[model samples]
Target: MKKKIRIKKALQYFGVPAVIDSIKAQYFGGSELFSIKLDYLEHPLSLRLLGSDVPTFKKIFIEQEYDFHTNIPPKVIVDAGANVGFTSVYLANKFPECKIISIEPEAENFEVLKLNTKPYKNIVAIQAALWNENKKINLVDPGKGSWGFTAEDSDDNDADLIDAVTVDYLLEHYKLGHIDILKIDIEGSEKEVFDDTSKWLSNVNSIVIELHERMKQGCNRSFYTGTPGFNVEWQKGENVFIARDEEVMSPR
Candidate 1:
């Protein structure tokens, strides 16, 4: 399964034409419900990212409307595990006034993330892992199995590691008083990020997270309750929406 997924990803990364060719070649007569094809370019500003072109788990999150319970239109957004920075760019464009801070740990991915957000001045891209503590730790590369980063002791593939910081530390360091919307999609490390972020949750107005139920390091499903904001719906998708309860805005 891992090999097959990797091959598919490789073909998709190649281009839209390669993706179409691979699908037709493999399935022949079968029909796929939907698919996204990214058109990567050599130029930084020319790079385009959207649900129509990029096959990512955050597509659903982008389509959904926030349940607004306050007058605040999300002046600040924290995007953890920004991947290629599509979501950060999207939010920045959607809310021009909002300040977006995207956190990504992988070296290669972080470069792409920075490039993708280069056109937007409101977005700040950081190349580091968000952890429970403000210290550096070794990371595990699961080849093609999962893009999720974990502690080195969790896996023994490569001996590479990087520095990390806590959410509270980031808020304090950046002088961000309250977060309007916080989106976390750090593969499987959502548990630790949330567990160690109790000090900052009270000020967060809205949250959308991608929960991994089946993880070797125990899923972080338990930490969802401590948050004070609104209790939104949950579906079997990449990310789930949890809005603030004070002002419930019906989905348009």
Candidate 2:
């Protein structure tokens, strides 16, 4: 069943035209990546196919995550696991006044994230894993670049250690009194973050997360259980929306 779903997802990722373009790009070998300039936001973005062309505009702009109808624009937005910085760019355009900090852990993905968000001065791209602790940890590279990076407890000693930061650290480091919107899609490390939302949840008004229980067991449970005061709604897709005030949802 999982194999079948993966096949369908791969088909969707390629569709018809992308497959042809991907093949051409492979042979030409001029640039490994492609640039996309969005007309709506006037934001330039770069895309690499290793699950990094990850469509997020639909959820950000179309779905309206940080948008508050009450005319209270978001002050600060934190984007965890901001793959390639598309989502951070989207948030930057959507809330021009808001300061966005885009965090991506993978080396290759972090490089791309920096490039894509560089044009926007408001977006600060950081290379750090959002985990429970501040210590370094082993990161499992599933080869799917943006989509499948996972954190594992290993004692290999020679294993590459990635710098990590906790939610508590972010609040203190950024001097963020309160996070207007916190979008977490940290692949599977969310289990570690949600392990304790007590220190962070009070300061966050809106929360948009993409849970991956299949990737890390109890991801859904951890988020659901940890955030007791917030209103949690599981959307149609792999994402979930939780808020302290009025619930946010897709208008369409």
Candidate 3:
């Protein structure tokens, strides 16, 4: 059954004790933080079920959603919408030499992200939403918990505004010559970021994005339109792995 398969995976990743603790946290615990130490990681990962972070943790650690392989080691990586720094921590361990820029917009999620990625010297956490332009935007939570915050352009006087920056701004601010791997999971806002890719698409060699067509219409259309020379290499879970046709594939 599916439940048995999930238990097997949990045992494979976290062992028997951690699995029991995870179940206790999910069912009995409320809003209390817990830490689990992974054998491959230098530090323990913090999580809470109240914010819906445990599901995200399971997707990344147990399901191995970002386990796609590459031919070369990446020099630079951009983890947009890095909720609680799970993916960033995974990548930082996978590619210790690569410089990682982890961006998260939600205040609470950003705090956890900073905590999770603080031990990794290669990761630089930034609090901002990645958009097509540099400006202020509103964070909208569609009742999908902490990992589901989406950014939208708003001119309302009392809108929950946050700093939004384009991919071009990231490159300039960090002085990154090119992005070897660009991982995007910005809820439904991929529609806005992919709407115009002229400024930073060419500088990126590969992309792994989760298109949110169900949340926002035209997300797939905009993403496909923006990526012209890139070819779909594979799809793992909800993410689509894309790489430039001419460039050598990077990021293991």
Candidate 4:
């Protein structure tokens, strides 16, 4: 497994040929806060000025073969945990007329997220964490990059408090009666969001989530149990694609 991951990493870095991307890393090709341009994409995208995030980019941009296909391109897409807005940008370009709502909690990442999606008028950016409520939550760093900032209830005094809202709140405020595509990568908080998802699960047409049971043990169960209405459309590595059998099964 380690060997395969390393091989894929090599392919994404040197093999994919971002030969023109400017780099100012701590060490050349070493993972310590390097800026990279994904000009190779339909819309050019760049990483945030944060340390050690290249691998996360590589995993989504290179290794994760998540083809955003639908019978008709998604009309409403919600990107939870939208770090740096790469996925949101891709969605916007792929679905030009679709409305995109992106949420990110980390200050540095949210700044870059806005910058990357600035050209797209269809995208709406939010700088709040999505929890099960509309309250302040402390973020815990899982340490490689801003990708692992989990919204958890805590009181360490030193930790910073940021605003959080439920998925239901997002749907209600956005007036999204039915979400065409709901992409969630909120680290390990799938447990919290899916705990009482009776209100929103039925309205979601398709869902692509990166479950963190490997990092937080009961996440897979939480997601699966909560989403009893959707079928496991497909899965690769840690990510799972789910949708209603009758409505969204045709898209895949």
Listed per candidate, the RMSD to the true structure in angstroms reads 7.2, 4.5, 4.4, 4.9
Give lDDT tens digits, candidate 3, residues 54-121: 66888898788987666678899999999899999999998899999999999999988999999999
Candidate 4 — which residues are off by over 4 angstroms?
Answer: 1-42, 48-52, 155-159, 246-252
TM-scores of the candidates in the order shown: 0.70, 0.81, 0.86, 0.81
lDDT of 1 at 119: 71
Candidate 2, residue 178: Cα displacement in angstroms equals 1.2
* Candidate 1 TM-score over all chains jointly: 0.70
lDDT of each: 0.61, 0.71, 0.84, 0.73
Of the pair 1 and 3, which is ahead by TM-score? Answer: 3
The best candidate in terms of lDDT: 3
1-252, model 1: which lDDT tens digit per residue? 212323444344455664565456445644322334333322232122221223453352334332233454677889987776767766775677889989888886677677678878888898878777877767666653225565432223344667677778778888888787788776667667765456887778777777776654555555564564566645435557677663522233
- Which numbered prediction scores highest in TM-score against the true structure? 3
As for candidate 4, its clashing pairs are: 33-51, 33-52
Error of 4 at 14 (Å): 7.9
Q: Taking the candidates one at a time, how many backbone clashes does each contain?
A: 5, 0, 0, 2
Query: For residues 123-200, could you state the per-residue lDDT of candidate 2 as single tens digits?
Result: 888888888888787878776545568876544566578888887788899898888778888878888888887787
Work out candidate 4's RMSD over C-alphas.
Answer: 4.9
Return whichever of 1 and 2 wins on lDDT. Answer: 2
Ranking by TM-score: 3, 2, 4, 1
Worst 10 residues of 1 by lDDT: 42-51
For model 3, the superposed segments whose C-alpha errors exceed 4 Å read 1-31, 157-159, 245-247, 250-252
